[model samples]
Target: MGQGLSCAASQDHRFFSAVHFGDLETVNAMLERDPSLLYQTTYDRQYPLHIAAANGQIEILSMLLERSVDPDMVNRQKQTPLMLAAMHGKISCVKKLVEAGANMLKFDSLNGRTCLHFAAYYGHSDCLQAILSAVQSSPVAVSWGYSRFVNIRDGRGATPLHLAARQRRPECVHILLDNGALVCSSTGGYGSPGTTPLHLAARGGSLDCIRELLAWGADRMQRDASGRIPYVVALKYRNGTCAALLNPSSAEPLVWPSPLKFISELNQEAKALLECALMEANREREKNILKGTGYSLPSPSHSDDGTDDNISEASDTELCCICFEQVCTIEVEDCGHQMCAHCTLALCCHNKPNPTTACLTPPVCPFCRSTIARLVVAKMKDCNDADQDIGDGGSPKLRKSRRSLNFSEGSSSFKGLSATFGKMGGRGSGRIAAENEWVDKP
Candidate 1:
């Protein structure tokens, strides 16, 4: 027994050293001498496969897999070799492990996070795409459905989307969204309940991430457990640009001439004419308003005796002017008038018209007859709310403000918006034009 124990220990030291340094020849020779050395665990319970994958030794990893080593063997943290490879951004190693039948859906017992989650958290876009492709092509994924693994949530109830957004991985965010990852999925773990990917993006101050999420139909009006929407979170973190983009007032209102006519069906010439007309009309209206000669449009009325009724309504200490239920926690921009974030977002940003209109109406301040420039999240004093604690120890924490908005150096361009008629022949326009043909037919 003593002799066997000594031999195993000696073999483990040499095997671990060889795998750690990626000495392919030494690893193969040792494995040939002691076939069982491939399965031997180090002091940390990490196998030769885990070491090779972690260190990005693709050649050694390939050799181990070809020798029929267990691909799914996990370490003390319950992290498999595939997870290690993904977390370290070893794309080639990850692909090899996946092709060799590594368990892609296996989650770490500690956090219940899958390999995709690790790849996303580490900002490995290529690694993430490879894992996604492997899953889609796998027979098990085909039988069980790819979404089952793609949307797998961690113990904290956070999906891979949440991690990508939180880590400010714009490429990973786009890849995940393109693959049908849920945008509005909320988390109930790690002191964050009902926190969506938009909230995470806002907190991280990732403008590209925010844009991607919004383009993918993320609900900005969705609130966290603290009753704060992504816009409010952006303001709280001083991400002014993100907040402005999310503000409904910043979007130009599209006025359709006819309810039956679809914007997509309009030909290039017709669309140009309509745009010119709208521009002329806006210029004339602005000039008239500036000259005080324009006809008065219907607006909210003020109170008699020189007291603003709107201000009074907003200043109601007992009730919120927007929701009329919850207490006020958010304040409108440029006007100190208060309202709940939930109500502010719903009243200003989420008020969608019928399908015929297909336009977004800008939100105005209820207390003041001015257009809402932006919304600011007021800092609460002595608040012990669980949602207020947004730290996860090792992950990126929300900052009061960032020096710059340029998070990702990659291209910021994304396709999903309604294509303009002028750019019909451009790249990505073919699909949009094809889809709109049915609208113009008959």
Candidate 2:
């Protein structure tokens, strides 16, 4: 009996190793000779499918699944192959498992974390997106509902958003927010009980995550279980850079204009234009906070070499009357008024993000002050006609009866809108967190 057991153990090790290294031929040969090897598992309860998926051995994984191996099988830790694939950032493996009908909602034995949690915690944005895409077309959407699954709590009551923020995965944070994850939901973990994603981001000192959270309407004044707000948490962790943004005394960061239905339905290119504008405005606020200190922001181009890929010399008619720096690329419908994309974004996203848009109103055109219902790409005009609209500065040569972008008529630039922008005229674009200067000290 002992001899038989030893032989079985050796064979199992060989088969598992074959699967792990993607030696599909050896695995197929072993499985063909002894089909029962498919039923065997290591002491940790891990199977050949788990090994193949975890190691990104897609061919071997597909073979095992084709041979009747259960896709949702869990090991001792209750982690399915799908969870392992996502945790390891194996995007191909994740997609394979999803298509194979692996259960995305299954939680691991250790943390009650689903594959979504694993993807977010491990900073695998692609994997996270894959799992989310699966949920939309799968039964998980029907039974558990898409929104509930997105904000599903782990054993510690932390959602995927919380994990992504705590891990400093900014792209994951943006995705979660885009998909309707509750921005202000609190975690139930003892280590950071009642902690919001904002608090975790501050603790981790990730400015990008913090910026996304604030843009989604995360409350800076909300306290955690210990009565500590994100600002206090940032200061405690000695994240001076993060603390500056989290400081409640500073100006409120601009929120995503979720209040406008048209804003959400904009074409991808136009929407991207506005989104860049939103981030640009908040970056300007961050620049103010870092000034008079040891820190120095890079020039507007964001390149140390000081060149902007987004900017191009434009004719006078194409110039943005507000900034005089960039072209008037976006237009308001009905009103037929236009501004540079930056000023358009600055106007729409300037309001702090409200959780709901029902009680809110759309922004009006700076020119006609009419309800600015729609925005589209603007048409460029002839230089001769442009000369008639403006002369030396960005100020309009022909003034409408209503107040002009409220400029003093001679300022030549956006500097005149200090009351609205707080003196932001950033070559009209990008964010400030690219420097990674917000990192916490060791």
Candidate 3:
């Protein structure tokens, strides 16, 4: 019998490739020659059922199961056909396996996760629904009320709910909750972040899943070992909806920590912006003063030279800054310093006063860090590589030439500087302009 099975196994290999290639009739012919061939295993210990499930071959799976093939048999990794079916979202195959009494509760020997874990992680809603249906119909009183699914850790100590939450599958989260999955279950699995399912959901900013977990009595009060609560995580992420679910009793509507910080940073930015506006007004005033005084404004060439000097000085003193983008508005500081407004805003304001927007700024620039500023500009420049440093205090002749060029309003040239130069292949002008347009566009 063993020898016959071994010979059949070799034939099964040929048939397995045929099956993978969709040669159904050929597979049928091989199996017909040896009825017991339906139960054969391949080099990977994968039976026809495993291949069928993994490949979404419903007909082939049905035929194999009808031959009494073991649907729950595990490979070397202890992953059963049911697990593969659930993972791959083969709904029909999963249903067939469940109907054939494939063990949904069988955990992978390596990961200690049941077939349901795979279904939940992959967001296979149909497969999950079918598995839950089978479990509900089984004689074992399915524990639908205990958050058992939530708390039951896998080899990694992650509950089914954790996988769902981490993958941002709201529907999967709902299914797990309905099946008595716990929201607070943390994995004892090595290197596990020791976070509850709620923590995972909140971190991913899935408000719906977070709400579902909270609705099912997921303990909002429980803090992960990080001393971070799910609500705090939501607030930290600027997810107002999730934060609202966590704290409902505040007299003053609790703002997300990130948004609050954003506002405070915005205030500082507003002041900085106001200062910049004033300085710009002064520069404009100076320009007017020169014009009205009949100082015989230098010839366009001479004026351009002075302008180049100004730009050079500006480039050196003013930091390019971004407010929300790489460069949305050129932030002219009180002292006339400029940078990308968005980058500066991010560096200076995004994280201040709010956990959500924290640490977006680097402490120093890779090149020069006098506290980098984000800049937004009116136009972009298409200068060649040699021209990149033209306005940054280069040769006196280059500076004079830079001053003569007046920026054309609404020109494509005015639309391109990003706060970070690397984005433009180490040039910085184009990004600022691009960010300005992005912010101005509705």
Candidate 4:
């Protein structure tokens, strides 16, 4: 019975070859000569759709779909073309299949994993996000619910977040968390059965993944089925840097500010600014945690173009009043007070959210007691006497503003962060002004 199909569609060998190698010309001629080739399956009943999709032959793929090829067509193992595209990290093919109305919830028999699972487990974040974006508006989301589908499990009861963490895919972990995957959900079969995403991240020894998971509220204290916490798992895997962060004795991790509607809803630029500030501050804190240990900090995990970070830039308004060493580029909305992005982050991250808490108190402005509403990239102001030499024939030159410095040389470890935090929130009026004048005397 099988010998006949194999003998007849030995022609399938040619058709698959053309689709796989992206020979659109040959494929078109073959289709014109034998229209049945477009719909024929190979010896294993693999559709032409799977070959074109897996090989990333977008031109041939689009042609197949145009000629009534099913995007969701599967082979013996029940693996669809969309799943194959995601498995191979073929983002364009994934998008094409998605646009052609492939079923996102279809699970392959080998692993009981959907396209999302394949994308995450294989570290294809772009493909993962594409599937998630489609699920948001698809009828499947309404029926199964969006968040539920995002946290959907595979045969081993591993969520996409768990797979991303175990595979050291930090960006995929971040994407899953952003799309409502539960950060602290425990696995049923993956890794230690009861292992959480944090546990898997610790075992994988990816500090970047740990940062992403912890910032999204992953519980480090959560235990696996064998009663071992993430810290123990980190130490078990010999991940000293990860162990240091997971250590209960170390300083608290900086969490993403999700309570402050203003901070949480900031635009992409502001968000990136806050993220860099958070990671840098955490890096500095990690130094203390690794004081006597042999482990050192790793290279930064993501690219930072530093469009708004100007601490080292030669701007007159570089020093922030709060930190006195960083550029004051972020502004509080209604209060109109400004501070360095780092210190601004410090205030928000000072209070870490409890993963089990239902509500949280939003942080207040240090300068004023007003509820901190929003943060914006403060516009650069010319804090210098730009018109100092504008006088025509010495018609009285303008006065120069007192030069601001990165605090003073030989200052204490904590400068503006000391007891003088809020008293200097505003420009000092009488006493401090007189002191400034006395100190600036030539």
The TM-score measured for candidate 1 stands at: 0.57
Which regions in candidate 1 have their CA more than 4 angstroms from the true location?
1-11, 188-193, 252-442
Q: Taking the tens digit of each residue's C-alpha lDDT, what string does model 3 give over 1-442?
A: 9999787657767888876666778878887887766666777777777888899888888877787777777887899999999999989888888788887667787778888789889999888878777776674336442334334568767777888888889888877765556455666445444688878787787755654565444666667777787778887887655565455231111111122223234444354543333222222222332443334322231122332223443233122332211222443322233444334332332133324854343223222233434332323333444256454657544453443232223223222322322221101321112212111000
In model 4, state the lDDT of residue 406. 25
Q: Candidate 1, residues 251-315: lDDT per residue as tens digits?
A: 32222222122333444543443333333222222222323323232322111122322333222
lDDT of all predictions: 0.64, 0.77, 0.56, 0.74
Q: Quickly count the clashes in candidate 1.
A: 0
Residue pairs with clashing backbones, model 4: 9-12
TM-score of each: 0.57, 0.82, 0.49, 0.80
The ten-residue window of minimal lDDT in model 1 covers 400-409
Best model number under lDDT: 2
Clash list (residue pairs), candidate 2 = 389-397
lDDT of 3 at 151: 45
Question: Between which residue pairs do clashes occur in model 1?
Answer: none
Off by over 4 Å in 3: 1-13, 34-40, 142-151, 188-194, 231-442
Candidates ranked by lDDT: 2, 4, 1, 3
lDDT per residue, candidate 4, 1-442, as tens digits? 8999677667778878998899999999989988988778776777888988888999999999999887887898999999999999999999988888999989999989999998999999899989999988899899999989999999878899999999999999988987788888887653454988999999999998998887766777788898988999999999989998888766665666666567667987878888776665455455556767887768742223344334333353345655455567788879776777766876675544455875556766665556777788877665344334322322111121222222232234334443333221211110111112111000
